[model samples]
Target: MLPLQIGSFTPKAPVVLAPMAGVTNRAFRAMCRSYGDELVYVNEMVMSHAVVYRNDKTLTMMQFGDDESPRSLQIYGSDPDMLGRAVHQVCDEGRVDHVDLNFGCPAAKVTRKGGGAAVPAKPKLLQQIVRRAVQAAEPYGVPVTAKFRMGLWDDLRTDITTGRICADEGIGWIALHARTVEQHYSGEARWEAIGALKEAVTDIPVLGNGDIWEASDAVAMMAQTDCDGVVIGRGCLGRPWLFGDLITVLNGGEAPAPRRLGEVAEAMRRHARLLTDHYAGFGGEEHAMRDFRKHCAWYLSGYPVGPDVRRTLAQVSSLAQLDDVLGAFDPDAEIVEGGERIKRGHTNGPIKVALPEGYLDDPDELAIPDDADVMALSGG
Candidate 1:
């Protein structure tokens, strides 16, 4: 397998933990990193305004443990100036090793504001934002990367153009989730698009994302697309050990043994504890556990756990109650197969996509909006 590099750090394997909002926090990243070797874990997307203004919640999200080396931070914003300033802050602070620009989010709130996928449609804007962010990050010896979708929609295919622009702008790496904003994680991801993108950009590594539900799938993605690596998003939700599985498969080793209910509960508890500790200085354990309740369904997805038990766990008001509910699970129950790959979060059908007037008329328009023209959201 090919090794992955950003700046001075090189991971033996080319597997990355995709940054998921409300997930991929320090707690989750720590859990995943513990099971694998040489995997890059990214922080969830932080809005540029929030970061610059020091929004408590956003700043809290940026927290990384002392041992968390090669820290990867993903920042989202449509305004080039704000994004550039944000990159400078992250690099100037001297806390991060890599910075990833987010252009793949399909949230309507982001798209309605002419950000995220919408920015790519206007190649000039995309170029400006990337250029500014790269310039800001370069001085600190921090590598700048970008993650993007194939295009804003089926009618407007811009992945090739956007990928080329990012390459020309000196991006260290590019990750393509082979689905358009319109596709929105609906149909199967087009691996062919990844192959085409790899062919489009030669200097930097091209990572293929989406539909990598298992370790074998990662192997297949590489073999089929000849992409350099894979970025896993939903596949590792309930199964953080997936990193271990990916490492094993990449090395021609067997997948980790199946985990039982007791083991899964233990992992859930561990995740909660880490989150508590990570946020303890700010939110305390009660708030942290409250935030962690959302992950309960994901953790116990395919298990034979009853609805009542699941409901109770979901409604858990405190960590002690959560512990009690988790401890109530049958430790000896066999793990049900296929739960590992089920989709979680943002699975709803496509809504009407928003775009600027006559956006498709000119793909080359890269107008950088002034503060007055800035929209509230940039990506969806």
Candidate 2:
């Protein structure tokens, strides 16, 4: 596979970890990076206004490990000036190596104000946002990128248009989620849209997201769409080692065997510890353990760990409790057949796309939404 070059940085593999709020923090990133080298792991999405205002929680969320190379961050906002200022603030402080604008978030709180997926409906506004971000980061030699859905919905597609605008505004690259805002995280992603975007935007690299549950699925996306790389999101939810499989298969090697129950347990223990360390200044180990509770069911999804054990483990309040619960499992046991393909993360979608009143009335208008307070939302 060819390397994914954005500006002066080039990852060894054309693989990027999609930013997921509360999921792609430093600890989780370290876990995924441990399995593969030279991969781009983006921090969770942060609000531009929060960064500009220096919100403590937002700043804490932006922290990167000292060893993390080529730190990448994803920022979302509806106002061009706010987003631009946020980009400038981070770049000026040398806090990030790459900046990605988020335009695919379908959350009602975000889109109700002509932000997120709704922005693409107004091509002019989308252009301004991408251009502002690119211009802001250009002085610092940081490449600005973007990730967006197919469009507001099936009838209001804008992937190709979004790609062209990004390229014209000097974006490093663009990733298409291949699903409409209406589709949310449900249904199959249309790989054909990725190919169309790749074909339309030839100047910069294009990457594909959505439905990449395995290494082979990533391979299929690149082959079918000729996209430069693949962005792994929900696919790597609990299986950080999926990065290793992706690297191996992309490099023409066979996928590695799944880890046994014991190995999985060990990884979980390490994740819990890392999270505790991460939350030390914020909420301490207790708070960290609570955050990690959601991951318990994910880690044991396909394993025959029984409902009682799963329930108990999900409520673990401390590392010792985590260990005690995990130790009861059969270390040698393997995930059930086809367990690797089980779905994780948000599986519901195809909701009504919320937008400002008469938001779609003028696709060329350059107006921002009223009282949206998009900066309050965290992730898309």
Candidate 3:
């Protein structure tokens, strides 16, 4: 198979982990990275404002383990200057080899402030942000990419126009989530849109995101859209091994056997262990495991989880506690039939996008709205 090149850097595989907040931390990224040398694991979303302000939590979130070969960090912000500075700092500090800007987030909090998916609604503002970031990263030889949605809504889709802009601005590549901010993760992704994005831009590679729950789905997406690669988010929530499966399938090899409960259990344990290690500074293993509670549902999804067992696992405060719980459960059971493709992240959208007032009055508004400044912190 061929390598997926981003500027001078190359990923072992064309698979990339979408930068989901809270979930794609060092522990999680390390696990996903272990799946393959080529699979690109992007860090959780980092706010450019926070990075500019040197916010401790946001800085901590930017930490990457030594194992993340071809490290990529996704940064979100509305201010062109702030984003450019953030990208420059990351490059100057040698924090990562690649930087992906987030223009696809559809959360109300993000759009309310004129950030995230909202920036793409204003082509001029989007152009400036992308342009400044590219200029900043170019000096360091760090490839910069942008991931965006179809548009604010179907009536005002910007996927094609945004694709053209990124191509002209020297962006390394473009990723289209194939849904509008209003669509969230609810409706089926429009693969045809990915094809349209690919067709519209001839200079840079185009990647497809959304609805790739299984390795087969990635294969199907590539075949259907002819995209350069796939960006996976909620698909790997409790299934980091999906990266391995993708590698196997994309490389002309059969995917590994179905993960039994025991296999999943082992993965969960490793994840917990990594969490403990990652948080050793702020708090030790006990405190770190507290955060692991949220992952219980995803890890045990479709398992025969009893309420009592679920409660215990959710509240597990230490690695030993997790082990004891695993000890009592049978590990050979497989994930429930057809559970592999469970809808995990990004809800469907019919919600109105909270753009700044008059955002839609003119699509040609060239000035960056004051409301569109970078969020102090970033998330979905």
Q: Candidate 3 residues 38-65, lDDT tens each? A: 6778888888878877887777788888
The C-alpha local distance difference test score for the whole of candidate 2 amounts to 0.87
Query: How close is every model to the real structure, measured as TM-score?
Result: 0.94, 0.97, 0.95
* Weakest lDDT window of 10 consecutive positions for candidate 2: 369-378
**Predicted structure with the largest TM-score when compared to the true one:** 2
**Model 2: per-residue lDDT, tens digit, 1-380?**
33466567788679999999888999999999999867899999998888989988888899899999889999988789988999999999999999888988888987887777788889898898888898899999998989998998888899988899988989888999989989988889899999999888898889999889889999999999999999999888889999999989998999988889998999999999999988888998999999898888788888878888887877889999998988787999999998888998888887998888888788899987542255445355
RMSD of each: 2.2, 1.4, 2.0
Q: Which regions of candidate 1 fall more than 4 Å away from where they truly are?
A: 364-366, 369-380
Give the runs in model 2 whose Cα sits over 4 Å from its true position. 1-3, 370-372, 375-378
Instruction: Give the Cα RMSD of candidate 1.
Output: 2.2
Evaluated at residue 359, the lDDT of candidate 1 is 62
Candidate 3 Cα outliers beyond 4 Å, as residue runs: 1-3, 367-380
Ranking by TM-score: 2, 3, 1
The stretch of ten residues in a row with the least summed lDDT in candidate 1 is: 371-380
